[model samples]
Target: MSSQLLPRLAQEDESTDALSGPQTVTRQARPLRFITCGSVDDGKSTLIGRLLWDTKAVKEDQAATLRRDSTGQHNELGLPDFARLLDGLQAEREQGITIDVAYRYFATDRRSFIVADTPGHVQYTRNMATGASTADLAVLLVDARAGILEQTRRHATIAALMGIRQFVLAVNKIDLAHYDEAGFQAIAREFREIALSLGVRQITAIPVSALKGENIVLRGDDVMPWYSGPTLVETLEKATQRTGQSTGFRLPVQRVSRPGEGFRGYQGTVAGGSIKPGDSVVVLPSGVEANVKAIVTYDLVRNAAVSGDAITLVLDRPVDISRGDMIAAIDQRPQTGRAFTARLVALSPDGIVPGKRYWLKAGSRRQRVMVRPVSALDLATGNWDDAAVLALNGIGVVELDFEEDAIFDAYETNRETGAFILIDPDTLNTVAGGMIDSRRSRSGRFDALPDADRASITLPARLIEAFLKTEFARAHVGEIRVTRGEKE
Candidate 1:
């Protein structure tokens, strides 16, 4: 959670010495990181197992265990208990539901993949969010019979909020629907409406039967000849990898190394932008400046290091730098302030309380901060409503007041430096995950608002007209007085 692969590394330069033969450099396609999430019994595990099984990512020994565990239980097609390959918990097998997030790594001729199979139950929504936080795309599964349910909407909304641009709609169990093309189209149409409401546009809907392995890695059978679209694996192989919010160079110092004689270096994974020797950098929070003298990795000098590289930087001058301090491009520094507003996902059972002090950790930096709920989202209306507390699995904006200077970029600008976690002092549990929105001044505006005047701010005609186009706005229909700043 401290570091993320935020950007793609540039191709390594091929160098040839005059005394040596030619050298060639080659690299495989970037691996895709995605998550599978939807309602329970939606066949997420089965789908992933089938993917791995068909790809031959599963070893013979593991497949043997699956066969033993599934001894007398085979589907009509004689497929093994594919879901058991992912549901490792005994309780999960007993209840036939996934409770924890399971991750699997696999590869094909085209590309490699890292997929997280997240729980679908409403209670484990936090688990789903955790899996989605770093995902480049989301594969939301649904039963052909059930269509789009509330839980489906919730997962889709969270994935979009977490900045996932690509979505794959796997309409599982098409066999149960008798491979009805009409039913498949109906579900895909409804899901598109929901996705559009959440501002997500890139979506691929495929009718599949995970249990039977149809349209997963192989083409559909004659029954579902109407589904001539690409298989799930084919879609994933061609899907794009995520390149997170771009920003100026940032390196949150994890350690300062003075390993040997006459050598000192700052160690950390580069979070944003690229760095090279001779570039001037600033040690944040202290304003001390230094010039990069070398970029070190595995004792070999690198010509340049970009985001996601784990390298040690040797500077021209010694500065008062330490753990938790950030080193950034001197010309494009991150924001430094004590107060900021952010959107947070409450992850604990106790939820987030107003006026509570929690340890806010962003990258290598951790500080005590007071959190106050400013306003929460009204899921029913998609409106920002005044809220005093943020409940479990709730996603809303809150105000963060740091005891000391807090350095971050707006989440829209740099995901690596802008994301943070809230830890409870008593239990040391991660209570919430947050993304920096925009900094706020040291103002009493939040605490000063009263219930009677909550929605008292008026808007211009153009603004009101803009609000009328939202999905929530249509549900209310002819019911508001914009001049008076109230809603019915």
Candidate 2:
């Protein structure tokens, strides 16, 4: 991709009277974006369909389509694609499953929502990861009878690992479990421990049967009398906690719009904190700073916009900028690096291991890289050890070397630009999605050590840190070589 074709930011402040136009400002709170994730056959689709149906989010025509598709021939089971109300894919209906993230927009009196119903099978783990990465909250579903399964823990762990703070454990199929209080409590207990261990801060456990509509939209008289919490709908409706923002402002110009009169517009979503007209901003990957002259949207060139608004920014100087480049406050700059090391889960059918080259897509940025799975920590022991390959449902850490500078924040910091997915070149299949924790040495000093030698080595922290730093610096300066270094 040519650097010139990327988006650019402008600098000026002459549009104070631009708001005098006809369009009225309907300023409202930004919608929250979230995702639903769980294993297959866990009633994920039913829960969402119920939510839309109960909330009247779906139109009559769409509901008719759902009904027609759900009526199978000869009264056989009709597996309609409930999620297709958003994306309407033929393959989704035929497979009766979600292959990709299907986004749906809905609003209540309280707040607006952009919900991504992600796939929930072992094979589509990457899709689930992608969905959960950007979500402020995760709605994790599970069968009441089949409580705390491996895949259940896996999904919960992924949600926590992705830095999602709020979790709603929708314990579906409670009717099948006879709405047993003991059963529900047992599952909730186990989930609470796992969630806490995985760093999940807030968890709300609800016992409801998605199929029977018990405790979903309304209270069920037949459900356990001891449980007195609000229904799923009510709980969600009452949730008013908004997500926090970055202390600094950063907006990556996705595209530039020129609306004539020699006015160049920088169009993109505000990815970081609030930005105002007088705020001094820097165009990154170029290291140029310019004061913000105007923030325009439709007929208004306003003073500021909170994060999540897709507004056009007009700066004080027309410097060279592009799509992959980021715009941020002059004093608060994001960290930059060419080589990165991250934890990745194998979403490929063949699994992820050493010498696997693929294309990585992070937000609007794409890069070619290779995933070398060095170690897999035993979940039971919490000890890292070498693995031949990380198969489906396996979690491991890998070293990634990008062909270009892939700008990103740590997953702990920002989920928007920090998460990415690997795509197979041959099939163009999204194989794995990952969150960058902390960058390791691209030289793979620790990864290259033999399994036997790694266990025995216990070098000083300073020596190990210096050696690793120098090794990676050399690799970044010249040829990409990750050969094993000196021992002892």
Global lDDT of each model?
0.83, 0.69
| TM-score, predicted candidate 2 vs. hidden true structure | 0.73
Q: Which stretches of candidate 2 lie over 4 Å from their true place?
A: 1-33, 57-114, 240-242, 255-266, 296-300, 311-318, 353-358, 368-370, 377-389, 402-406, 424-429, 439-488
Tens digits of per-residue lDDT for model 1 on 250-346?
9999999998879999999999999999999999999999999999998699989988899999999878889999999999999999999998888
> Which residue pairs in candidate 2 have backbone atoms (N, alpha carbon, C) closer than 3 angstroms, thus clashing?
7-322, 7-323, 10-315, 11-315, 11-316, 11-317, 12-315
Supply the global lDDT for candidate 1.
Answer: 0.83
Error of 2 at 470 (Å): 11
Question: lDDT, candidate 2, residue 136?
Answer: 67
User: Across residues 1-488, which tens digit of lDDT does each residue of candidate 2 receive?
Assistant: 11112111111211111111122222136556678887777878777776777678889898887778666531223445454464356777777677788878777665567788888777777778778776767878889988877677677777777777667788888988888889988887777776667766456778887666678777876657888765776555434333435537878788877779678778888777778889898887777788988899988778788777889989787777766778887887766666676777776777774665688887666778866676775655445688756777677777777666667677676666667888888889877778786665555443553333323445576765675577565554443334444763
Candidate 1 lDDT at 219 equals 89
